[model samples]
Target: MHKKILLAYDGTEEGRVALLECADIAHLLRAETHLLAVMRVPSGVFLAEGFVPDTVMEDERQRIRETIDDGVALLREGGYSAYGHLACGEPVEEICRLAAELGVDLIVLGHRKQTSFASRWWKGSVGISLLERAPCSILVAVGT
Candidate 1:
């Protein structure tokens, strides 16, 4: 029985589905929820540039905050004790870090969605690496 849970919400279709599932599980376990939205910094050019511009950083921060806000609203309206934060870094790293920091017994996330050929070919892989490395147990929810 988990007393605390860490949930990953990225404002994606799959992630939204996971939130509903996490709510069900959390209610059953009477767990407190901690939602995390990670803003992944580009590992290529952005890292080499040393620092991101204030305008770009703020844009990303606001987006992440909105994601967290949505998650917080769901949990609150559902009568769950919930907290959330927006983080900047590698998505996988930040998610895992927040989970451990929260001392959660469970980490919840959605499986990555399939992408179009152009994106699949050009973009980086989804951060599924967190599943393999997380210290706590993970529950993956499928999208509708």
Candidate 2:
């Protein structure tokens, strides 16, 4: 029943798994697919410097752009055309904002299993946060 789907892709192995799964699901549902790549801005960017260097920002953007392009290509290879979006900021915030804007029926994400509680605590869990804040149903493709 999903008419539109948003996939949060980060070019990780987990992301590739999600992309493949999403491609199948999208094809089955005849859904519009959107691939989102988020560039995480470091907290230090808001500190004394008040901003990241233009060159550094550009580099980050370019990297994210490439990641999005790669995702699009993968989807195309799978026989599904997808629109790619690049967002700069926190993952959950950007994902929620775009899901709301796109009115997507489902949001797909890739997650790597963390064996240690400390690791999860230090890094925080975007998937957990998204479960609370996301505007649509979420499907997480877990990877080893």
Candidate 3:
């Protein structure tokens, strides 16, 4: 029953698995797909480093854009009707916000297996956070 699927892609191995899964599901349901790559703002960079250069930020933005473009291309090559978006902000916030704005039926994201409690505590879990805040159903593709 899913008509629109949003894939949160970051070009990681897990992300690639998520992308493939998203594409397969979209194809089976004949749904439209949108790939979103969030460019997280370096909020703490200035505070930690004393100063942040504009060019460095710009380079990061460019890389995120390229990643989004590559995701869209791969989806297209797989014969899925898909598009890409680049957003700036927190990853969880941006993903949920875009999913709401697009009125998507499902959000697909990859999950990295965090083995240690310390790692989870330190990095937090974006997938878990999205599950809490997302307006639609979420499918987390856990990497083996």
Candidate 4:
């Protein structure tokens, strides 16, 4: 039984499904669900491009908030207790760090769109990396 669970959401097709799965598991275990969305922010790249505009960061924050609000609404509609959190930085690293900080019992991750041999052979899966590094149990919800 999980008392606390972290759901990593990328807002992709499969990620949405994983959110639902996380909510389901949360409901069953009576666990508190944390929905985490990590925004990919370019660190050195922005500074290299001279000065960063204020609107850029503001726009990103607004988008992140909207995503979290919508996700929270969906979970509540499904009768699941959920909370949303948005972080900026590398996705996998932030996810792992958050899991550790929050002390969650499990980390629920989403599998990206499936690809054929050629695609899979070219682009590696981040899910595998997260599963390998996460200290807690990982449940990968596959398929979009």
Q: Count the backbone clashes (under 3 Å) in each candidate.
A: 0, 0, 0, 0
Winner by TM-score between candidate 3 and candidate 1:
3
**Where does candidate 2 clash, by residue pair?**
none
Position 65, candidate 3: lDDT: 85
lDDT agreement with native, every candidate: 0.82, 0.91, 0.92, 0.83
Q: Worst 10-residue stretch by lDDT in candidate 3?
A: 43-52
Count of backbone collisions within predicted model 1: 0
Which lDDT tens digits does candidate 4 get at residues 1-144? Answer: 799999887677788889878888998898988899887765553765685567887788788878888888898888777889999877789889999999999998888764687776676666777877897898998762
- Expressed as tens digits, the lDDT of each residue in 1-144 for candidate 1 is 899988888878888888998999889989999898888765453555697777777887897898899889989999999999888887778887887787889988887765787775676444457657787988888875
The alpha-carbon deviation from the true structure for residue 87 of candidate 4, after best TM-score superposition, in angstroms, is 0.5
- Model 4 TM-score relative to the real fold: 0.84
77-109 per-residue lDDT for model 2 (tens digits): 877868999998899999999999999999999
Model 3 backbone overlap count? 0
lDDT of 3 by residue, 1-144 (tens): 999999999999999999989988998999999999988767576755676778888999899889889999998988889999998888999999999999999999998998899999999999889979999999999777
Task: Please provide TM-scores, in order, for all candidate models, with all chains considered together.
Answer: 0.85, 0.93, 0.93, 0.84
